[model samples]
Target: MNGIAVAGLSQNNQSESDIQKLLKGEILLETKPYSAWGGAVTARMYLPLERSQVWQQVTDYSRWVQYFPALSRSEVLHRGDGQSKGAKRLYQVASKAFLMFTAQVEIYLKVFESIHQKTGHQIQFSLERGSFTDFSANLNLQDFKTGTLLTYSVQATPTVLVPSLLIQEAMRLDLPSNLQKMRQVLCGYFR
Candidate 1:
């Protein structure tokens, strides 16, 4: 479906039960064709924490490998100069997945983060050098009553000859686990 339709579905499905399910480690993930050759993965959940707390957890690059099982390394290569909202920061990440043996991929990304003082926070990142031919993503956090609603969307095209189906399968299997881990770690801070 289209982006608007997917967003509408997500909003409609955001019930109290859904929020409870997410807090209990359930994650909602969906995929769609963003381009003829590339696809998009959208993961959404209601987090039982303030927006600031959620933002902190996501932007803390040094601790990503600790919470995200697939990530073997997360390092900040360069810090933003703070000239503008679009100030650039560079990061390197190594991720691995095991089907029979381990398959590892390392990526370098340039990220720009922006905060809307009245609304929410956003982080947009694009691949500078990676296994993927093209990769871009955004994390958006919005206030949801007492908690926060987090939505992460990524679009990617593999540089290698990997089937799109395999990519989608990997995303479906991995995104929820990553989100669940993030939720658990962020929740611990409050308790």
Candidate 2:
């Protein structure tokens, strides 16, 4: 795909069938198929905002599609509330590919959990399925000289049999760019 592939963005416990859980900080956790073998992915980010602003931005998550390479286009499939639990507007997420190299590869199910006002960010998102055998991340916010340092950490297990060295190389090449973009977007938002 030339543009981004948007995914559905829904609430954590909107459905009576959906289970409710409380976790610290802003994060996403889930498991699904990665080719033949199933996997998991977690992603999180700390915004330079008070509790309200963080909630606003996260609840209105379709805005994030603008920066993500895989999700260039996004829309709210449904709507929800910030107070009482409800499903967030879902999105259709797709990957952007480049000839031989696929620019993005991921399909997710939105899960917005509880928010800790004292902590500073909202907890949401979990993978319903995709490429990695495992995908999970956490976003932490700390005091920065200029603003807030939005630190992100993802621990994943590749679904394929790629060598660790190759995977390391890919991370080295991609992580910096991804981090820079995140900083730019968040900084711009706050500034």
Candidate 3:
């Protein structure tokens, strides 16, 4: 079980297209490094599972959406040949109330093995030509005394006009909760 506790939820409208940038958008950034272009919100959690066990949970993709909230359904777009090759899976996630839109978000995820021995597994994900332009994460799982530290380093460049800050806030709220839910489900299964 990843001992992750999450609270606070926010809502918003789905206005991703044809929207003017806020004049105050510039002021919103307190610090500016011109190199900072766009994309990504990451969440980390420690779960009570061995690295290998966590890897198994994630690889068993078919059962994920069933346990995760808003992840109403999932389909295996393609399962690669063998142990090391990548497998492609498509996901249909339900829209949240905050977004104020019932969106059918499709995700194409490819699971690959990483060279780092400490990092158990790596899964590459994308929006699959949908509302969002680019969305991906490098999930790293490390061993801990009580459990495992699961960290998701996310990178996403949304094509939609919704403020990047808003998107980041939403992700900050959603990702940790999502992981906590997963931790609970996995813990229950093991128990």
Taken over the whole model, the C-alpha lDDT of each candidate is: 0.73, 0.44, 0.54
Model number with the top TM-score: 1
The candidate with the higher lDDT, 2 or 3, is 3
lDDT of 3 by residue, 16-42 (tens): 220111111100011111113334555
Ordering by TM-score: 1, 3, 2
Q: Could you tell me every candidate's TM-score relative to the true structure? A: 0.82, 0.53, 0.69
Which of 1 and 3 is the better model by lDDT? 1
Of 1 and 2, the candidate ranking higher by lDDT: 1
Candidate topping lDDT: 1
lDDT accuracy of residue 157 in candidate 1: 80
Residues 27-111, candidate 1, lDDT per residue (tens digit)?
6677876555566788887787989888887888878886778777788787767574455655555656545555567788888
Among all windows of 10 consecutive residues in model 1, the one with the lowest summed lDDT is 1-10
**For all candidates, what are the clash counts?**
0, 24, 8
What's the candidate order when arranged by decreasing lDDT?
1, 3, 2
Deviation (Å) of 84 in candidate 3:
10
